[model samples]
Target: MRRKSLSTGDLARYCQVTPATIVNWIRAGKLDVYTTPGGQYRMELPKFIAFLEDNEFPIPEELQADRTRKILIVDDEEEILDLLVEVVEGSDANYIVRSEKNGYDALIAIGDFKPDIVSIDLNMPKMDGAELVRRLRSNPETKNAKILIVTGMIPTSDLVRKVKRIGVDSFMQKPIDIDEYAKALDKLATFKV
Candidate 1:
């Protein structure tokens, strides 16, 4: 899995140039990019890598593999959510995380965050993680985002079937083991498929 797209500043630092120079490259049609609503440019990972290869720039190790990745976590329980955040993002600066208490706001955040992986509780109020997974799968923009169910709910045969059809990438029981969580994230973040 690829990380989020690079900002002009991020790319500039990699290439040892000013952000203005990166923008000039974009303006001159030497590199391709998409602009956010805020008018900032983003260079997609694959395209940026291709650009570097074509131009003979050294691909930074971070861009090449095990780079900083985005993660989004959703749960309704405030205490549990805070604990999960503390555990997930506390020691690891490589993971940038965002959290929401409901599926609705999580959906809204997904539009901008474009998280590489989402760890969500299946029992969230209103839109539940199952439906959230369905909606994410249905969207072309987010269809491939990896979903990990981190919930206290015990898995039933029927429930397993339901989410299997919904296409979840992984699962973790609540009272999550930090090692297991880290391993799951490591597998999904860099896994090719």
Candidate 2:
């Protein structure tokens, strides 16, 4: 378990200084601390962390936050799927990526992966992207996941309106322009960052 507070000894050990020095620093008001009933000095976690950071001290490993993002790609075309996987994985950002050939497999993957972003192709064999988007919007688990609709067909005004009403974040007409797709992913993932 992570410690909620640090003692003089703890700070001294972390700084490679004597316990007396910690007490001196506390007495001089250089470090924020509180006194216990038994006259023990205790530094709360936040203050200690701030002191370390403000002084350019290395933060402990356990205190560092994970910045990884998750992505799920749903498309029936094998070529498109492979290309997307390659592009997303090859990016500089931290992402855990998965690809599914159809919406059914995508749905199953989403249950476990709970991706932050879902890049979906509109037409597939078993279940289309439109139906998958509806399901995602309805589900509590994935309701907030960002959806980027990628389609080969020129959408009618009604189809565009329907998808927008269904809560897609953005759309890209495809022959899959690599640059535009990468830009879309960057924009979608930026919200979380």
Candidate 3:
């Protein structure tokens, strides 16, 4: 059966949260929402299910899918990369996670695997996160790639403004929280193809 998308109000009622909280989640890159040509927001069913599962919130049995979700992580630090993979693997058996040590390698992998979502580190030995995002955005094939920039650098207000201009899909702090990682992935999965 084909599931229907839900509006913010509908989702709030279903999740037992306020509409304002839903809006905040959307802004925080926790909830995935689609914008119509007229700029109205709606949530996709599969992504909503993923969000619920990631948060340990209850989900209707019928809403669960059999297939695994694919994810890619790009980072220079081996420890962090491994840790991210471990967390995702432990969270759900249905997640296929892969990692790359640098942005250049990650780009190459993306072309072949075509992951549902990607998490990238802002600093690396080769290409940095900002430049990687620019390149991805410029390319027709990867223009719609869902990218989350994870960084440890403490940025000034000016730097934050500049980072926002890069057009990254989301941003997270370093030493990633497991729940937050899952939430970001769930949100990215909600994006319309």
Candidate 4:
């Protein structure tokens, strides 16, 4: 059956939850939704069905035991991107890390690479991290994709709150710690949804 876009009320009824709970899910990034030009939300039917079947949200799986997983790293700084590439290249964990200078290019790479995880920098030209997160969350294809915010900007508290609010799966601070980065990827690799 083809499913049309649903409103919050429709979602609440189908999910057997209160409207407030649905709103919380949206805020928590547990739900995938997009706002119209008039500011109304449209929910994807297939993902919603998957949520019902699994009783949990879906997220990308890890790279195979034998093959490297594809990862997209978005940042404007050449030096930082280069450093990240170097670190990933040195890791025991197999990963195909692709770097993009800005969010615009990152969006394009997202479609082309179909990465298992995305590490995004908060500050960038064209589109900032917040907007990029919003865009990723809005699109059904990328909505459940694992996202990690790696940024040097923003205070710690603010950064934590913002990332949580947007439903980012994980986060890391700049001056990239190789161990921590590895840990984050490890966690994402194992994450079921």
Candidate 5:
């Protein structure tokens, strides 16, 4: 499927320019963008690709949409979701990372995302992580998915044991340690959807 959009930084990286340059382009009416309520800018993926082609700019190999893996991030905290998205998407893995703030949305997204890896929090609303994990394991489509638990909910020994019993592939605490996060993702990178 065609990726829907690109953040200013994503476009800037592909075009070999600073994100500020992309912002300037938008301000000068050189490039069109949609601004989120949070004031972040996003450009339609197809349109940006066309613009690059028209301008004779060489598109980065990764930007050509040769994504190898899809990652779904589930967390109830909006800030955590944003942070995780930024870290994972900003990496050079060329993985598609999508985030949902609730398990219900995450469940719906999982079908569409068909993710190779799912990094989730334990204490989510609508559906808790344990229930989500059970559902994923029970569903043939997602049973083989690599599940990583990332949460700040103060895990007790029981919680750890329970998650392991549910077949989580890995676990990390928040605020996430970047090295550990990268390591976990790297470990899961061998799996394909």
Candidate 6:
């Protein structure tokens, strides 16, 4: 299998440093890097991960290949939640899934799991999805979370506008297509700079 590679910018984000610092590290031989034909520096993912571990640097979620990506699903209907859990857990990609019946519990789970992506129902009871999204956006920890809203509720044009204002990454209708959902999850989890 071809090894994943990261650019200096990607490494900088993981290290919480500027790309210039990454360039300096490469110059100082502190980090291993290779040059493409076009002379862009690239670091092998495995080597970079090992380097971080050896130096006791905090590995960002984007670099945690060993850890299964966590996904949170929130829907008021037990059946829908179960179906989502089944689809995500049965996916080809490694993932750990948690399901909640309402946005309230989903919030608690978010704090606990720090899920990479959240698939939520807009019509959930007890703290609707809109309010939940607002709270997630307000908090620094989850402000950048990727959100996908799945709802059967026919949203009016205004409601769609409202959801856009809250900054959801994607939206899906209820009775979700398993294949489509899986593809979306793969994109979100394997995202690289």
Q: Which candidate has the top score in lDDT?
A: 2
Return the TM-score for candidate 2, rounded to 2 decimals. Answer: 0.65
Give residue 73's lDDT in candidate 6 (0 to 100). 91
lDDT of each model, Cα atoms only? 0.82, 0.84, 0.77, 0.77, 0.81, 0.83
**lDDT: the better of candidates 4 and 6:** 6
Which is better, 2 or 5, measured by TM-score?
Answer: 2
Total clashing pairs for each candidate: 0, 0, 0, 0, 0, 0
> In candidate 5, which residue pairs clash?
none
Order the candidates by TM-score, highest first: 1, 6, 2, 4, 5, 3
- Work out the TM-score per prediction: 0.68, 0.65, 0.61, 0.63, 0.62, 0.67
Worst 10 residues of 2 by lDDT: 59-68
Q: How much lDDT does candidate 6 score? A: 0.83
TM-score of 3: 0.61
Q: What lDDT does model 5 reach?
A: 0.81
Q: Distance from true position, residue 180, model 5, in Å?
A: 1.8
Of models 2 and 4, which has the larger TM-score?
2
Looking at candidate 3, the ten consecutive residues that score lowest on lDDT are: 59-68
Writing each residue's lDDT as its tens digit, candidate 2 over 1-193 gives 7778899999998767899999999889989999999999999876886677556566565543334568999999999999999999999887889999999999999988879799998888898888899999998668878899998878785656677789999899988888889889888876531
lDDT of 3 by residue, 118-150 (tens): 788877878877777778878766666678878
RMSD of model 5 against the true structure: 13.5
- The segments of candidate 1 whose C-alpha lies over 4 angstroms from its true place after superposition are 1-62
lDDT (tens digit, per residue) of candidate 1 on 59-167: 6766757456778989999997887777667645478889999999999999999887888888888898888998999987677678888888778756655877889
After best superposition, candidate 1 residue 122: deviation in angstroms?
0.2
